[model samples]
Target: MANQAAPVRSFLQAAAKTEEAPLPLRVVQIEGLAILKIIKHCKECSPDPVTGQLLGLDVGSVLEVTNCFPFPTRDEDEELEAEGANYQLEMMRCLREVNVDNNTVGWYQSTFLWSYQTEDLIETFMNYQENIRRCVCIIYDPSKSNQGVLALKALKLSDSFMELYRNNNFTGEKLREKNFTWVDIFEEIPIKVSNSPLISCVMTQLETDSPVNQCDYDRLQLSSTPYLERNLEFLVGCMDALSKEQQELQFHYRILARQQAQQQAWLQKRRAENMARKAAGEEPLPEEDPSNPIFKQNPEPSRLNSFLITNQIANHCNQINGAVGQNFSRLYLTKALHEN
Candidate 1:
């Protein structure tokens, strides 16, 4: 993987030179069947995060995701890790033999309540980005999809964060210099579902043969108390986690400040002792700076987790608000009918 990164970087550089301007990646085109497969896979792995590889090509700035396959859910064992890699390799080999898009464009994973951002996820994205410059992570929220709407997102690690992450420098000064924020870490790429004419025709025929039932609309209008209750619970949990992380960060800052003050005081004492030796006409001791190589700088604590927790809380709030609005509308309708 390390060796492969150079060629990928070289290719991107050459590609950039040929273009009039650096073409910003804009669209993620996924086949309708591919989307169905992703949704099905997510449903099967409900309550657990499921991941798979994406196969496609990059044409200009548009990424066409033609196919995907789910990875088996296995525990973190060395044997399983080896098997997973082999499985992916063999799968890509078979796709190539069939003249399909065998290139590894990115990968997809199922997330619950927007809990997709984490250190593990960041590391995975970084690995993919190293191998494929335009690699993205497709997040599918099955919980949301079950609520009559599909929730899919295409996200790529932002270039600024990528550089910072590569250097393994999350120092406070560096973060402040970059003006880094939670939102800036991952850039969401717009996605559009696509289908061929033949596929579209087949769908139309199927729709005619098995028309959607009107009763489904009535069921959709019914309030889902369990869903609402679960969402609120999740929201509260996220808020608690967010608050705890904030406190931890504040405590870390105080500790860091105290350490700095102690170092300064020690340095001052050493300087005074050296001055006294000079006054006594004795050989001055070698000056020692407390801020030397021996005192390694503390790596800034990661705020990525806190930021992600905050984002999840926001999503939960939005969901709760939508549910409440629907309930109020139903209540108002019921009252009006009773009056009539």
Candidate 2:
């Protein structure tokens, strides 16, 4: 199963120095430095999504991400995919020699408009699971951050969902049996940015100079029209994708229905022929024919794509709701100030 992250095997094996963390990872404690690095890398890339390997230790329930570095992006897609593994391995070796936290905890990537729910992401997670017992993908959405919020999150596939996904069965019956839903696909672990005492003191000292930083204006800005419009666009796209998946499912059902109808018609005709032969004192042909194409079972189409599309749609809706809520709050505050 060489996937999008197939090249990470060498790097992960080399970085496997710590004890494997137990299941059901609870929290992700990312260092302040790592957060800055992720933001910087993602912001520098801007519209282009970039990926990087996360380095740190996973202790019990808390996965601490201490450092990270961006993956090299080449214009030729194949060249990058082929060389990406080697780049990570070399980076790990260099960091290990320098006595840095070279242990591979997980990986991080930037997303567009917080739309990180996709099969490609799941494939990468499965790839990481091969080497690491537990891992999280730190998702940073630069597009969402423009609204004055730190759009970083720690996400991992839910245990149950992963189990079902491993079997590659996203059939509706199987999903209903397992109580799996689109929302259950990814488990978002709470992220806590950890800074050292010295760094904390430095930050406190730096904050003393300003009662309110100039950056606060970004949040206070009432111009949310663009954000709302963009979110609606993404939502509409997801809706169209979801419709296409539904059409596929419908087509599968139509074919299945037609097959079942043909099988019934064949059986009726066979029964009538047997009755006529019996009246004529002649031998009757067998009613059941294994060779009949109508008897072949029609497998239901995979529901994974539809489920993922639904999840993506939910993400867009949540963002839209959040933006609307913020707008309402600001409007109320402004009204109160004007009244006073």
Candidate 3:
């Protein structure tokens, strides 16, 4: 009940007053900044079930930046220690703020599988399994063609959230009586992932060939192509160091074909505008007015001009090399790809 709306609003207000936005080159503070790191990279990253443009969501497309943390894994031990028990207390406090009673909170573990304790915050943590079991909705993008992907899996952990919190290794009985186990702190919010109702709901949506369903089926049908087999390790490393300009350049390269199509559209629009006036019995506009020769009869942009425009349009549009250039070079890249 600690982070009730009034208190949290006050805290956010106070926090906002002191927090300064980071400049282009400054370290960000945790109290203000939020980060979401996605671990997506797989072969089935495509939007279509069979064949479509190969523009699947890469392992790099970060989804949302919620105030909540990712379900903690052992890798985050150091962070947990640094943040202290207040972290667990805060999570419970937030739940309580929503009017979840103590009785309902106890049932949360059976539904979700994590421990919760308002007092012993350090060792008492919510089990991610319990949270997963209670998740009401799941979402993923469908635009990416299959260059890469991330697979979501059901929680298989045996312990509850509070059990694994491992602050000082107190006994299970003590934890249960103290309301440190998953059930003690908050009610099971009437949502359960593993509950029967959710299974049918998941099954209905999963019957289709959507990315989520494909991911599930692929796990059972095909042998996984590990990330090690791909250039992803190098890609991830490269991505970490990419400048904004470089990132934009990469995006431009990815959509070069579409960009070409868009230019043709613009030319068509101009021509149509000229013809429309002629049809209306008005003086047809010249391609370029003699008074403004620059606007008169402008030559169609060449590939080179498009490249320069792309760079001008986006900061990260620095010259690209390798496959990116193969798709976007001024010269014949499609022919080159076919030859290869």
- Please report the candidate that would top TM-score against the real structure: 2
Query: Which runs of model 1 end up more than 4 angstroms from their true locations?
Result: 1-22, 75-78, 209-219, 286-296, 333-340
Model-by-model lDDT, in order? 0.82, 0.90, 0.32
User: Which 10-residue span in candidate 1 carries the lowest summed lDDT?
Assistant: 210-219
Q: For candidate 3, lDDT tens digit of each residue in 180-294?
A: 4332222221211222456557767867655465554433322223322233343343345334435655565556656556566666776899798889888866443345423
Clashes of 1: 0
lDDT tens digits, residue span 1-340, model 1:
4655444557777767776465689999999888888989998979888999999988878999999999988767558878999999999999899999998889999988677767899899887766776778899998776666668999988889888888876666788898987677888999999999999998877775545655445435656687788888888888899889889889888877877887777678878998999999988775555457434565567767776787677778888888778778777887888899
Best-to-worst ranking by lDDT: 2, 1, 3
lDDT, candidate 3, at 211 = 47
Candidate 3, superposed: residue stretches over 4 Å from native: 1-82, 101-193, 196-212, 220-340
- For candidate 2, lDDT tens digit of each residue in 136-212? 99999998888888999999998898898889888999999998888899889999989999999998887766567
Candidate no. 2 TM-score: 0.89
Query: What value of lDDT does candidate 2 attain over all alpha carbons?
Result: 0.90
Q: Show where candidate 2 strays beyond 4 Å.
A: 1-23, 276-284
| Candidate 2 weakest lDDT stretch, 10 residues | 14-23
Candidate with top lDDT is 2
- Better lDDT candidate (2, 3): 2
Q: How well does candidate 2 score on lDDT at residue 192? A: 91
Ranking 1 against 2 by lDDT, winner: 2
